[model samples]
Target: MLPFALVASTLNSGLVSASSYKPRASVCNGHAELCDRSYGNVTFIGSHDSYAISATQVAANQDQNITTQLNDGVRMLQVQAHSYDGSIHLCHTSCLLLDGGLFSDYLTEVNTWVVANPNEVLSILIVNSDNLNASMYGAVFETSGLDKVSYAPTKATTSVADWPTLGSMIDSGLRVVTFMDNSADFTTVPYIIDEFSNVVEDAYNAVEDSFPCTANRSTGTPENQLVLTNHYLDQVGSSTSIVTPNKSKLNQTNAETGTGSVGQGASNCFQIYARSPNFILLDFYDAAGLAPFNVAAELNDVSAPTNTVANYTGGDGSTSTSTKSTASTTSTSSSLSGAGPQFKSEMMPLIVAVAVAVMAGSGLMLA
Candidate 1:
């Protein structure tokens, strides 16, 4: 059954048509120099738990939606997946805590964006907390039409140096790269690659003010894999075990140059590993405006973008027009508005009980 489904998905998977051989992109990812650079060599600013977006939700990791993040030059997006109400959903920790939406819906938005931006390459990292089968994810991708633009490598894992240039990926129309942190079976779902096999990462869920450059989670040879630096700071949330983004530290954490800054963390990794990190993941990226992007640009040797789209202010759930500002480079501790809805200490037990009940009823094991 799985084989048949995989075959069906592949046939409908809208890989770049052979007849429509487009010319190589002159500018890839906002830079002509990056067009010729290997996709693995380029540095990209990433949003941590990109789908957990809200201006008022306590569990929200981002203030803007996925489309806004992409438009503002966030090339990589990280999402946490879990089973909820008999379907896959983008959730944080657990659905009872924070539910972004259905996985298919999320992919549809991404598909729409990828189709509209032909010259840009995007990457998505899924943290499969529920340990769902790769084909289950492949099914969602197929239904959402995201499979149309998704990239499938010839092998399960490719060395960093062997990756194609960004221009080639864009020209081929296979611009979206998908990675799964766990339970990724490439033989069944070729487009969803295993992340640890191709990428290495620094520590995550960090609470320390000082970010370390040492490898914390990696199965692949560090030298042969792309580097991903987890640069976000965390703090104890409603409970001692529950950790949330340290919102108060956003200005320093996402700054271009400072102690505990993204720049400093990336630089530390580069000095120890002898290469720039391919991805630097952050929370509330809009808090410090384009600071993360500036650090990435410096690492990539490209000029930083002059302006950025303001953080989402849509309180009604409808997509709102973002105002552009040239003053994004300056540290913006003041722009970190709305402390968000606070989680009551008394609600933690109830939330945990409900989450456990839901998981038990669905026969899904939590990670």
Candidate 2:
């Protein structure tokens, strides 16, 4: 059976019935010089655990859906693909732990966005958790019609300086660039570029104080490879299963402060590489205002508006959760509103979960 078969019947029906929403404007607009820079020179805000957005404690890493993420100016999408029952699904660690629906569904949404936004360049990083060959995953891209616009390097390895400009890529109709963390068989799927060859990233689980600017995993030095900075902090817990952090606190403090902030993260990395990072991965990028994009603009020496969009609010306009808005190519006010959770951010999720449990227990006691 196909992966979509595993989707809950009600949810599958909703997805099928919902009208296809068109994507927002391209984030790359008005930055023509960005295209002139090396691929490694560009900075992208990546979605960590891109598929984990269901809101369940074990599974939810994001507050909104994948298309919402894309529409919010996230240029790089990082996901884990696992093969289950002969079909691929986007999951975190294991499909049983966090099944994110069909891999085809994801590529289809991306394909729709890519087709609508012709000028933008998108990057995808896949963690081959199941160790499936490139062709296996490539087949999905092919079927989704993404392969038609996918970019293949002319050689085994291409340096930042040699990488085609964003405009050049768009003109050539090669808009999508793919990277695989493992099991990349370029012979079978040439577009599935091996990630380590072109990029180096810091450890994903790094805390704020010891966050090393140095490469945790890379084939070469930061000077030679594109720097991917992993800036999200995991809430300290006794176990990984209980480590989910509060999304709002993540938006305010981590996304706004010290080493976690896009400017500071870039600054910390510049100390080591003599240049800023190429990719900045965040958990809730929508809450960071214009910090990420503005930082990228500064690094690229291009003009960026000082203003940022208003911070997103939760579904009920309450602090129970948070969500982001559609992408905006233009700028708004530059002030960092510092708007976020009224309660402490980090422990909010656990608190909410615990509060519900306590209320349930109190009712049981009365009964």
Candidate 3:
């Protein structure tokens, strides 16, 4: 037997060695099987117009705030950028319709989440409605410190197969992937790469309940680019051109399996494209709770998260309390139905000017 001092020293040394031998991360995005999968190959549920959140605001595309959405397992965040008050703002159609505040503030909020959750990989898709320069967006990202964790691609365009795996991104500490729908100058800001160059998107603002899958927008080769299916249902307003989320169909639209369900849309897209959709963007995603996540899990061939958010009662009649229910409860009101802001007599001139600018340049009346 060793002396008392020697025994204590040996135990301490063993503890140090054990502590130093830290195992690498084996799980990513809540799945061990996804660690080895490429980022482009993995399916991520996205919140369309994620910044537009309000209980009473009719044009609001999302119910919960950004933090709530991220906490509930939305891996991708899609926001529309518009010029307002001489700065980039996250607005729905026109700022007069729905102003979500400054883009930098939004980025700062996202950066906070990214720093806190180091292991999670996030994707940000910016719809450059104003076609702002990449430098402008990059400046905001830099100011917010989000650029520190952002992934910069070597080239402007990358084939879906060439993207790095989730494990590699997590290990490197540079995990946030960003894309802009327009004016993504790689030479100026390589982190915010061109979206259409690497992704093909299905037509947005679906008026029909069928939710047909088609490659409506893409500059990259469809076969090699990542597939982004717009899975939200929209209803025509007083005019055929005006459209808003069909809140009445939230249950059926976001169900795992049924007509116009996210599951059906994903399966249809998979069958048509011969590959799984990389991102499925949904409006008011919390309405159906884990249904969208389950659909994504099925597409990725992985188990879905067991936690529940919003008012999702299982088919067996087992009701689970919402992780975040404040905003969702208010969203159920019948008064929440409008494509844009109610016009005011005094604000008409400014609204008309902004509307003309948006419609003439991008024709994005609906997000």
**lDDT of candidate 1 vs native?**
0.74
Rate residue 305 of model 3 by lDDT. 79
Candidate 1 lDDT over 235-257, as tens digits, reads 76443344556777777787777
Tens digits of per-residue lDDT, candidate 2, 1-367, equal 1111222231222212212322232334346555444455566778787766633343355655566666656788888889886798886555555566678878877888789888788999998887888888888998889999999988757665566656567767787999998888778888889998888888775434345567889775556777898876555443322444445355443343453555566677776766566688876555556655655655656676444343443222213222333343221111111232234433444455445446655311000
TM-score of each: 0.81, 0.75, 0.81
Query: Can you write out model 3's per-residue Cα lDDT over 189-208, one digit (the tens) per residue?
Result: 99998999899999998867
Estimate every model's Cα lDDT from 0 to 1: 0.74, 0.62, 0.74
**Native-structure RMSD, model 2:** 14.1
Clashes of 3: 0
Q: For model 1, give the 10-residue run with minimal summed lDDT.
A: 1-10
Clashes of 2: 3
Candidate 3 colliding pairs: none
Q: Which regions of candidate 1 deviate over 4 angstroms?
A: 1-23, 237-239, 312-367
